[model samples]
Target: MAYRKDNLRTVKQAYTEKRARALGIARARLAELHRTIPELCEIDSALAETGMKLVNAITAGAEGITERVAAIRAENEELQEARAATLRFYGYSADYTDVHYECEDCKDTGYVGTAMCACMKRALSLLSLESAGLAPLARTQRFDTFSLDYYQGDDRLTMQANLEIAKRYAASFTPASESLLFLGKTGLGKTHLSTSIAVEVIDKGYDVVYASAPTLFLSLEAQKFGRDSDIHIEEAEDADLLILDDLGTENPSPLHVNFLYRLVNTRMVSGKATIINTNLTVRELRERYTDRVASRLLGEYLVLGFVGKDVRMQKIGT
Candidate 1:
């Protein structure tokens, strides 16, 4: 499996510590065994000697030495039984060698039979979450904190419809899911709905990349200007789900505009899921960006219009 430097460092450090702990446990167990029954080790040495004798006898002459070899083999078997009994007295299984590995196949490398190891994939996924800055998002917004009570009864039907759509969209998200475009005025729960979806998908173990348009675009611009465009593309292209919050908030340069188009197009063509929460209306989006951009979005995106009074304004008693 191909791993980035950071991922590799994390995995290698974790695996090394795990292996060390296992070895330490194995050593302590063996030390207890040797203290409790010192004769077992002696028997093991004699058994090894007898094994060599059997091999040497088989190589020399297979005729008269058969009886001697048989007697030695019988004695070795008896010693093995005695050793096993000693180990049983110490409460260790016969197969408890000095290697307490979690997986004997790849020894917890999480790979076997030419495929990514399940454990390794889980590690990579966790590292991806750390890389994507999801921890802060989870702490800031929570679904349980969402109050449908804030929705307006004047547009009760529209508000209920939007809530149900958000619920269903979050509930039914898959890797092959179509993109989403959340359109409405500011503070109408657009950010809340998208962040809620991000939480759900993240809980299901997908790597969700959640960042505002300004934050993401600034980072992309920095990478491009600093000669690190490849890093920008890799992150944008490879995330399982991309949540671009407040799309019209960023200062649009020609480089950023083209970058945004190519980023969205590349992800769409590759069938990766994207969720864009924008306060801009359709007409505004077309004017601010381009018709081609708006057209592609309208064509492929599952648009959900957030409906309600501005919750922020209500909180401020405006």
Candidate 2:
């Protein structure tokens, strides 16, 4: 619901393209019908002229004009019906000349009066599909691909713990939830868990932003330097869920520290849920961000500690 002007433009573009494609398909089918059944074309031509006749009859205002107009309108309806029937005879469904839009109420216009139509919601979902990098993430984790078979009995305890926590976190996700921090070493399935949560939260129809630390920080830096004021901050603050992966990977600077603090602080105050996965330990986090920032995270966040030998190495037989 809280979409940007550009996002609204995306919705409009999607709607326009969908409606145009439907109209194009109907036009093509009509043309095909014209080629196959020439009488259908004649009926369509008569239906087109009926409007002119109705207007002329009303202007002339002769007695019995109402009955005449009604008769002409009825004939026009019958012509449309006959044309549709001819198209059906040729294997197309009824309503051959109609646009076959997703939303009949708005005809893919995206809005009805002041309210958003169903087409707009579909457009937003479609836009998210195009913008979010979901395919690659999904390909990596087949639910069937996960196996306790490889887990090292007691050594496998780490992944087992994380798997349980991650599953519960995903299942219990609500809009009014606290932020999450997944702290662990490399190849500990932190990214996998967080990205999985991203997919789940999106399914629940929440706007979620999933980006690595470097990419997000760079975008924030660009927005800061550019004349456009605080675009990244607004996006971060307003998104229903923020999944910041690889938290310690970005180049640290005073600006970065300040920006992060402000971003975290604002999100915390607003009670927006954020999920941050970091390789930094509690001490390193304190060193990078000040004690206040680190302490607040420790106190407020639901920390899910990731443990285990690097799974990537095991996969590569290292």
Index of the highest-lDDT prediction: 1
Backbone clashes under 3 angstroms, per model: 1, 0
- Cα-based lDDT at residue 230, candidate 2: 21
What are the per-residue Cα lDDT tens digits for candidate 1 across 143-257? 6667777885756577667667777777887767889899999988888777777777755557677778887877787776785431355766677788888999866777777
Query: lDDT, candidate 2, residue 100?
Result: 89
Q: Name the runs in model 2 displaced over 4 angstroms.
A: 1-9, 42-123, 129-150, 227-231
The clash number for model 2 is 0
Name the runs in model 1 displaced over 4 angstroms: 1-16, 22-126, 154-157, 227-231, 312-318
For model 2, residues 1-318, the per-residue Cα lDDT tens digits are 434456668678877898899899989978887888888878878978998888887888789888988988898888878877877887877776677888888877778987888667656654553345444674565334555545576647867776777677777777568888999888877788777776666655567776777777787878867845323656667777887889888667877888778888888888788988999999999999878778878888988887767878888994
